[model samples]
Target chain A: MPQSMQPGDAKAAEIKAVSIGKTFGAFHALKNLSLDIGRGEFLTLLGPSGSGKTTFLMILAGFTAPTTGRLMMDGKDITDVPAEDRSYGMVFQGYALFPHLTVEQNIAFPLKVRGHSSADVKRKVAEIVERVGLTGHEKKLPAKLSGGQQQRVALARALVFEPSVLLLDEPFSALDKNLREMMQQEVKRLHQETGTTFVFVTHDQSEALALSSRVAIFNHGELLQVGKPQDVYERPSNRFVAEFLGEINLLPLDTVELNGETAAGKFEDRTIVLNKSITLAGKKAVAAVRPEHMFISASPQTSDCNAITCRVEGATYFGASTKYHLRTRSGTSLAVSMPTASTSPIAPQSDVWVSWPVHQGFLLPDGG
Target chain B: MIGKSITSRKILLLAPLLLFLGLAYVVPFLGVVRWSFTMPEVGLGQYRALMTDPLVQSVFIRTLRICLIVTAAVLVTAYAIAYVWVRGSSVQRMLAEFCILVPFWISVLTRAFGWLAMLSNRGLINTWLQSAGIISEPLALARNELGVIIGMTHFLIPFAVFPIASAMRSIDERVLLAARGMGASRTRIFWTVFVPLTYGGLIGAGLIVFVFALGFFVTPAILGGGRSVMVAELVYLRIFQSPDWGLGAAISVVLVLFIGALLALMRRFIKPAHLIG
Candidate 1:
């Protein structure tokens, strides 16, 4: 965590895209999108399927040509440059290791293609193999290895050449849960140690938040927003980003009044204030709060908290936390998660008070 | 318990095939083997004579040489066509697939005759060249080793493409993309990644075509013009023209043994399980 606070290394490479667009027979895979990838920054493209995040990553890697716009690396136009000329390392979703090649040979392929000497290739391959914790698997074919091992081989191969940028397309999606977490840590450590620019694509929001310095949310072939993980999570620009990042409770409010940057609204005969008023003057509005931010109590606790009376319909236990499915008195379904360690269990079908600080909620125009 | 019943059911289903193979193929082939060694007071006499006979030796060598040429030609042509079939657009793939399979739907004899029509002296190619003033006279395109190769390769392309394209299909498209991303040029990716991954298909197709070509009778008979007699035609001539059944049986036995030896050698050199397993 401390390492993430440090600025990117000065030697890191930067990539810039200017108004990139791609169309395949009138199907717009990527719209007119522009973004700047900082040197040595971990940027994640987060979206559901068909959201064009993978297409954008492909365009960045030069595997796909943008229908309109130019890509620049260090201010040099590389829009038409082929993938091989870009010299970026990529780990595909399936970890596409050459089936015939042994792990060592697979890791050495890029170096050998780059005309590295045999000794240099060997040294680099050995170091990367060890770095990726695949020391004894050097001579084993990819099919002979486990899925996790094959993924490690892919990571090692991609990182062996010290490429200017490393692009990963859901590298851990195929891995089991434990292996996925382990690989995530491994990738983060490698990114930290090498300080190479990394552009990762995944639909898993937790993965996007955990591994990236900046998360770019995509939906319907358009970029919704790009910012730091906390910024994006706490202050999503629209309803899509808010609900997509995690479990959110959207409570409809009426007669909203804006006061500077804050807004007060009436919901279920109770006055509630939202800290961030991003809604218009006279439009339907909803106050969105993440499940973890809301609290469920037997009775209202504080005057400062925006509280609502709800009936606890059910509870799902998650070891460290419990999520209570609740329905407000006015019949809006909502959920609130409370840490099991600090909160007592609430019986199902019981009336409860759900409350959170006004500062924890954001206002968005309804039906966003 | 369920697994045992399923396996028993599978064996029960296999009973008919096992019975048919035992009666129809194994029995007759065993009879041929017995006749080769036992007929006309034979005790390795035919084998010894076959080794020493210059005519038989030439036929054997010629069969092997022609099979090698056919296998190589079929492999190269099939690899190109299979590559297109796997990686090209749907239209291009359909066209390539259609061309490769044209020799299959039509009978082999018909295709050979078609080739003979186009390749004979003063045939379509020669006439075109002459009319276009590219040459002074007709070229000998048929009834030679070149003609045999052309005809055989054409017939074997579809067989070769099946295995190669199946192998190519199993290769992840992203692997090639990853190679390109890692600075491998298109040509480099083909040789290093694409070709090596498809080695299983190549070897399987190669063994199939080579073994098939070694025993070919019709293509070589029509296109060989008697000057390039292969082993199968030699066996035919010994039995039908000269009325030497024992010699023909001996040659057939040798051909089977040569094929077995070649398969054994190929197994030793390349383990077939590496591709499939």
Candidate 2:
């Protein structure tokens, strides 16, 4: 794995995007986005469609130029560099393998184009093929290979030249659920093995969370948040980030009061205590808690937990866990996911206590 | 049973086309075939004469040479046009489509005459060149093999453009981008990734243009001005002027068989789907 990198390439390159923005006529595809991608980091740009995540990745790959901003690699500015000179590897969506070339030829393309010796090209292609687990399938064209095999070929082709940075644009969006998971694991292992700076773009929250060293969330061309998966998931800064990451119950709060390291807010008649400090603005706020963090109980389980009384509306059994749909007394709908094994089969229309630790709930600005 | 019924229904749906081809094409082709061997003496005498005829041999060789030249020129030019048509901006694409399709919709005779007017010694191009002092006299741009090639290449470009453009359009743009992202220069990417991907289109276009050029009659006849006669024109002269229907039918039969063999050979290299595209 270490020999794959050429000498003086042990430390991967870092990227800094400063005040990057892209506009297409009247539309804004990205707006004043600033980010620092550390060396050898696996950063995933997570966003909905048309949310500028792909736009940023393209900017990083030098395929699309930013309308305004400086893109720096290590320390030098590369905003004007063309994609060919960037020395980046990109796994495009649908794999985009060369249909006419066999897997070996496809992987050998970049090396040949770079004027590598024929012997070097053959040796590198063989190495990358073995690394990507495509040993016996070298002679097969992309059409003859299965979808997963085609994906492996694409990956091998992109990484054969040992590019300084690797960018993947939703490379697994076309695969089935099981194959996507398998490829995700494959990509994670490759990222670990190669130690190249990887900038992956995807809308799958779990994919972003499970694979990335850091996740950058985008919405409406705005960089909403960037943090570790746990940091963003457990402490989302806004309602959109909280909801986009996963299903979360946002209970509208009123009369919010801020204190050091904690905030007290009112949820109808119940006073909710959040263990994190939050600044108050003119707009409303919501107490956002993931459904998995809250448990359904017959009565309050602990004095240190915030409890809410709600009537069970429905229950969805999901094999290992059950999701209980509940409505508060003031008619705020909430969902609580509990382990099916420990759940006592609460009936609909029955009042139950939903309790979570004080630190599990966080405050977010409720734009709605 | 259901599959058999579906096959029968499909054949029924194709009945009109089958009837049209049998009457319009197969019947006439069979007449030509019958005349090739059993005309003017009910023997293989015409074919024997054809085998040794120097005029026939020269005409066939010249026709092959012209078809090869025209196919090569048409594929190279149409590949460029098709590339623009597939990957260019909307305005450029519209212009390319207009250039290919407008001449396509015009009559082949009109296009041939158009080329004649442009390429003739005393025509627009020569006159312009002479008036501009680029030449003291008109160059022999028409009334020769060069004139015939120019006319045939222009006429066949539209045919080449469709298959090439369809193949180009179906290529994944991201493949080229991926090549670029992997440190391949634009020219390198074009040669390595873009050109290889369009091999199907190029082969399909080459075959269509070559086969079409083989059977061409009007462009060569008009542009050749009797000096550069092709096999098709020879067949025309044999039947219409000399009234040698046996020889004419034999030539026609050979031309058809050659084209069929060429298509069969090409089919070994390219799939029907690629050709259609």
Candidate 3:
């Protein structure tokens, strides 16, 4: 990838990872992954367990060093800098507030490490106490605080130092659903109020969508994609991104040939043609269409370039929407999601026509 | 009915320990207490003699002082080893455990005798020093407070290690990591997080090791020789050599009362379960 020419492209304060890789014995925990985050952008690293998100975050925070390559904060190499000297704020998975220290002391710890005077630490700690909505908790020890209050204190401790970037490792995985959503908004509000670069890690895609400006999807120690939340979710680059981000109907093609302006593929018992470029010379491919994009009707026409004859396998009704599982004669299962209305096209055992625009389906390279 | 059954079950499990303590501990201990008051064909006769006998009273006082020193030394040394295991890498932790358990497998008499050979004036250590051309003459190694302290510390390191190490292990790793991430140095983390959390173990180990060191027979007897006369050896001499069972029982009674006082003080200051765990 070519580097962007703009030097201070608002991402100037962001952490830059260069050829970073970490391995434990023979197992490669992280590959040669590089990313340049935009400054003050809420970027969430989304992946399942062991996808190297936490490893990358730890390397960025200077707690753990990368096996190979380097890191730069604010345009200077800080790969070998110790965790204390790097001055990066971090909220760990378990909130990790000191049980021995009161809320005020916990919040003032990073400042104290920075050699702040008692008067200044007290003033800043009080300010942060208000900032995290933990006003009366200053005198209470961490053990006395509720889970949500402990989380707030941890956040206050990180933000009090006002570091260049804040790294949060699954900060909300411990909270219940309602509190998780509330804290998500609270974090976003804090970010907006401070304009501090926030790098977060989570396995939940909904969380990434709800809070992040850009979500980096990772799998098996490799970065699958990184883009705006809607861009990555709606227009995925491959099948894995599509499957991981949300539900999608994956239809395999036996063969795909790109001929001038036209693209065509042969399914099990029939042939399909597309008027758009397929980008494949001669290789096996598949088209991934999101479940909600499939338009189903009672009858189908041969004149329609984007249509398939499918029999309904099952239908499931969510509160506001219904999902229909359609199987073609060749036994290829395709999902069609339609908004519930007065006239519903899908009930159990109904014959349906699955149709969508050619642009709605993407021809993913095989095994993507 | 259910409450009675639960009480019976508890009693069944506790019965063997109660029976063992009854014969081995309480019976002999009560006999000594009874004998302390019945010496010289008069009640409290030998018990009053201890207060009048300067030499014997000094022996008890000296025993307490040396035992306190040994206990303090063992707690500090064992804490160093425990702190290392709590924070150090796997290999360092395992090697420390191996060193501690090695002495535990060997007999206490062998350990005491081993110290005797090491601390002896013309022992292996002085021989090595003379051959190395470091010292012209043999240094004092045996029959002194130095020799007794050295032997007792070696014997008690394992007892100290078990509780302190167990307490250090129970401490959550996240607590230390949180401290480090918050920019506490290695030294600061140990002092602030590890030490306070392991306070219970240190106190418990100190109490147990101190009480055991007070009545210590083999190490001090062999190494102290004539100079360091602990209460246990004095009692042994009175009962076995001089046939003074009354004086022996009186000394035994004093030792038991002193140990009980030490335990009561420890309990008042710190909780035992917290430390031992």
User: Each prediction's DockQ?
Assistant: 0.82, 0.79, 0.42
How well does candidate 2 reproduce the true complex, by DockQ? 0.79
Ranked by DockQ, top first? 1, 2, 3
Per-residue lDDT over B204-231 for candidate 2, one digit per residue giving the tens place of the 0 to 100 score? 8899899989999999999999999999
Higher-scoring candidate on lDDT, 2 or 3: 2
What is the DockQ of the complex in model 3?
A: 0.42
C-alpha TM-score for every candidate: 0.91, 0.93, 0.86
Query: Candidate 1: which docking quality band?
Result: high
Candidate 3: TM-score? 0.86
| Cα lDDT listed for each candidate | 0.87, 0.89, 0.82
User: Which stretches in model 1 have alpha-carbon errors above 4 Å?
Assistant: A1-10, B1-25, B118-141, B261-277
Q: Which CAPRI tier for candidate 3? A: acceptable
Tell me how far the alpha carbon of residue B52 in candidate 1 is from the true structure, in angstroms, after superposition.
2.6
In model 3, the runs with Cα more than 4 Å from the true position are A1-12, A253-278, A295-307, A339-346, A355-359, B1-18, B41-57, B84-94, B124-141, B241-244, B257-277
Number of the top candidate by TM-score? 2
Better-scoring candidate (DockQ), 1 or 3:
1
lDDT (10s digit) by residue, model 3, range A1-368: 12221223322267788899999899887899999888888899999998989888888878888999888877889888888676767898988877777898788777877789999888888877887899877999988988899999988898787767888999999999999999999998777776778999999999999999999988888888999998887768777888888888877888787766656677765566654423665667786778887778876545544788888988888867788888987888888887878346557777777777665666777786
- The best-first sequence of candidates by TM-score reads 2, 1, 3
